[model samples]
Every structure is written in C-alpha cells, then in structure tokens.
Target: MTRGFADRIPVHIQQVVEAMVEVFVNQSENIGNEVDYLQVFELSVDTADFFSMQAIAHSREEPPYSTTTEFVTDTAITEKVYIISDDYGLEGEVITYLLASEY
Candidate 1:
C-alpha cells in the first residue's frame, strides 16, 4: 500500500511552511499596537506539488477589520507578507493562498 501525496507531506517542507508562518507573525507584531496580533488558522496544503497552502489569519484591531484573499507565489518571504490592507499596514484579517511551486 502506498499513501498519496496529500496524505503524507515531507517533514522538511512542513517545517518550511511553519517557518514562513512564524515570520509572518513576527513581522506583523513588529509593526506596532495597531496590528493587535496575527493568528494563523485553517492551514491546508496540497502535498501533491508541495507548493500551495491556504491559511486564514485573524487580525483583531480597530474598526474596518476587513478580510481579503491574496496569493503568494515563488517569492522570498519578508515583512511585506503581512501587509494586509492599505489603511493599517499589517493590521486586518486575511486568507492567504501561498504557492511555492517554483521553490
């Protein structure tokens, strides 16, 4: 019997994903109190390509705390990843779809 790609993702790849999330959280925190905080939830990935993951980030702060979806693909992970909205910089909730296929 063999397990499918989606059933068993490589440990190292999972670690990389975790690291990316950590960086996002850290960067969001460094922004300021206006950010409140960033939390990652509902993290799902397609291990078939080991290149995509959908995560929901809940950011609690001021009013107009909107939610949006963004796709990140084959790009270096930086503080910019937490820039959810133009109004508050790293403040606001969002669902991020990340694709690292090229990696």
Candidate 2:
C-alpha cells in the first residue's frame, strides 16, 4: 500500500518544520517563565509550480487548543522534488509571539 500525501508531507517537510519548531521552543524558554511544550497539532505546506512554498504550522500546549503557528519557504525545488525549511526571519517570529505571552 502506498502512503498518501498527508503521510509523505511530514517526511518531506520535516526540516523546515523542525526549524520552525526549534525557534518556537527557544522563544518559549526565553520568555522567563514556566511554559509548556505540548505537541504539534497541525502542519501543512502548499507548493506552487514556481517552486515557492507556504507552510502553515499549528501547535498547542494542550490538546485541541492550537497556540502556535509558522510559515516556511521552499529552499530548493526540481520538477518533482521540493525542500522547505524555516523562514525564521518572518514566520518564525509570528509563532513565537503567539506562545510567548500565553504562558
């Protein structure tokens, strides 16, 4: 049986997603309070034919309540393959802020 796009997406997008995750985690710790790290609730990436990609990340400290988000970019692309990583300078800041004050 073949896995579907949702399953494959994580493998293909892990690098970028992980980088985004790292930034959020670091920011959480820097907030100078006891913050929680729960888990990633949703992560999706959409790629355009022009090799540009948009990543949407949603995470939460508790289930069913997403508290973080991120958007990454495609760093490399071919006709059929694409690479995405954290757009730390942009999207990373958005997500980090979401969690920082929530704690």
Candidate 3:
C-alpha cells in the first residue's frame, strides 16, 4: 500500500481488500500453477450514494466482464483503482496493494 493511500484507508475499502485477499489466497493455495501473478481491480462508488460501492477485479482470461468479485459497503472513501500483484523477490511471494495513480 502506498503511504498516501494508507493514510486515508477507510472501512469499506478494508472490507473489499480483505475480500480480494481471500480470493487471492484461495486461488494460490488451490491452483498454484494456474493462478495469475498479477490482479487488477477497479473500485467505483456511486456518487449519489456514498454508501454503495462496486469493486471489479479484472481477468481478461475469464471473459464476460472478467470480474472476480463485487462488494458494497457504507463509507465515504474515494478510492479509484488499484492493483494487487505478486512480487517474488528476496521476501518470497510478497503481495502489494497500491493505488493506480501510485502504480
């Protein structure tokens, strides 16, 4: 997570990130060889209703929107887009979550 994004983390964003991490972990554990090392997510909130939000994790390999999950929660955080990817460096499989702008 970027320092800027981390400073303003919101509850709703927390929920969505947690959900995405669950999916990532499950996929890695159950289908290690077939899992994608990189995952991209776009988070858009309803301007009229801040309480509602939609998060899309795109995987063009899975057509039909390629969306992995969608979630809704109540909050006023304005996260635009972010990506979670695996970086197998000296730290082993280190996963990172950062804003698109930060990317």
Candidate 4:
C-alpha cells in the first residue's frame, strides 16, 4: 500500500479493510483463470462519514464481478484507488491499495 493511501484508511476500520482484501482474494481465486492477476477496487465516501468499497475481479475474457461493503466511521477515507498487484507491479496474487494520483 502506498503511504498516502495507507494513511487514508480510517483508523477504526483498519481490520475491515484487511478482511475485505482477504475476501477479494478468495472470490478471485474461486473464479479460476476467468480472472487475471490484476484486481480493482473502487473506494469512495458516499456520505461525509461513510466509506464505500467495491472490490472487482476483472477478466479480459468475461464481465467483471465485484463485492461491496460500506462502513460508518467518524473519519472518511479520502484516497480512492485500489488495484491488486505484486512487487513486480502487474503480476501475482498480491493486492495493492494506493491512491490514483500516486500511480
């Protein structure tokens, strides 16, 4: 995770984010090769204190599947881009959370 994005994650919902990542991995893997290594996450603040996260498992050959969750917190998450990647950047099961501007 980029420092900016990591820092943007609300303190009270840290565990929620971690669990979301784990669930995203399982959904992607269960779908098999239909999904490519890269995954996408759409994050936003629906309300001033509400954070919405939509994790998408995308595939070039098929339509994307996504899972979403919402959190009510005292602080809103401002950073808003999520992609899955390894140290190599574009390949591997590792998922990364970072701001769109940072990339």
Q: Model 3 over residues 1-103: C-alpha lDDT tens digits?
A: 6775666657567566667656765765675534555555655555434446554555423322244555565654555555455766887776566776777
Clash count per candidate = 0, 1, 0, 0
The whole-model lDDT of each prediction reads 0.37, 0.41, 0.57, 0.55
Error of 1 at 103 (Å): 26
On lDDT, the leading prediction is 3
Candidate 3's C-alpha runs over 4 A off are: 28-33, 47-51, 54-65, 68-72, 76-78, 87-90
For all predicted structures, in order, the TM-scores are 0.29, 0.40, 0.59, 0.59
Per-residue lDDT value at 5 in model 3: 61
Give the C-alpha lDDT of model 2. Answer: 0.41
Q: Write the per-residue lDDT of candidate 2 for residues 1-103, one digit (tens) a residue.
A: 0233223444445555556556656776686533343444344445566455544544554323334443445532211122122345644622222121132
* Cα lDDT of model 1 by residue, 9-86, tens digit: 344434544565556556656765344333322233322355553433333345224332334343322211222223
Model 2 compared with the native: what TM-score?
A: 0.40
Question: On lDDT, who's better, 2 or 3?
Answer: 3
